[model samples]
Target: MKQGIHPEYHPVVFMDSQTGYKFLSGSTKTSQETVEWEDGNTYPLIRVEITSDSHPFYTGRQKFTQADGRIDRFNKKYGIKDENAAE
Candidate 1:
């Protein structure tokens, strides 16, 4: 490893804006904003739009489009039928 050539890695606080969730981790990224964590230590604050707390996939709020509905609509318009349905 080389000395004095790498960005300084230090503790950083990532805050999820929507859920107000804060976590501490180490990173080379620096921010002008700082926050006092639960441990009473000040760390650089980084605000993010989406995190596991508010993400649809993580929260199981995912909505899937109805593929069968689209197929039925197309078949109704074009007068098409599956072989199983025709039989």
Candidate 2:
């Protein structure tokens, strides 16, 4: 609760370049680019590469490479069987 020393906290739109998702939120971020919103009014739009809409984690596209089952392949290729393996 100060005077004019505080920065401007305004509504800004975040546009996801990957999924074309638009989100409205308050930000101190500045942008020289502007775009017309659904209200027929223009607002500052921030273009980002990825967002939750297209993120791999959110979309469940995360992949964990096992290197073609290296452990199993190695055991099979070398005839090295572990006693812990169940039949």
Candidate 3:
């Protein structure tokens, strides 16, 4: 609750670079770039590489890696045999 100590918060447009998706939200960050929003207002434009719109997890395009354990992976890589397999 101090005065003259907080950064200015205002509407800013975050744009997903890959998909060209734009959304307006309040932020303390500022930029020299500006963009016209859908609400007929101009706000600071911030370019980001990834957002929910283009992220693999949100878009359901994520690739699942192998579930092999560390020991199993190391043995396979160095062609080592598992002694426990003979028991």
Q: lDDT of each model, Cα atoms only?
A: 0.90, 0.88, 0.94
| Candidate 3 to native Cα RMSD, angstroms | 2.5
The sequence of per-residue lDDT tens digits that candidate 2 reaches over residues 1-87 is 889998989878999998899988789888999988888878899898999998988999987777658788999899998899789
- What ranking of all candidate models by TM-score puts the best one first? 3, 1, 2
The per-candidate count of clashes, in order, stands at: 0, 0, 0
The number of residue pairs in model 1 that clash at the backbone is 0
lDDT of 3 by residue, 17-84 (tens): 99999999999989999999988999999999999999998999987797989999999999999988
Itemize residue pairs with steric clashes in candidate 1. Answer: none
Worst 10 residues of 3 by lDDT: 78-87
Estimate, for each residue in 1-87, the C-alpha lDDT of model 1 and write its tens digit.
999999988999999999999889999889999999999989999999998888998999987876578788898889987777755
User: Each model's TM-score?
Assistant: 0.67, 0.64, 0.81
Model 1: lDDT equals: 0.90
Give stretches of model 1 more than 4 Å off.
Answer: 65-87
By summed lDDT, the worst window of 10 consecutive residues in model 1 runs over 78-87
For model 3, the stretches where C-alpha displacement exceeds 4 angstroms are 83-87
The local distance difference test score of model 2 is 0.88
Candidate 3: Cα lDDT at 27:
97
* Ranking of candidates on lDDT, top first: 3, 1, 2
Residue ranges of candidate 2 with Cα displaced over 4 Å:
1-5, 66-87
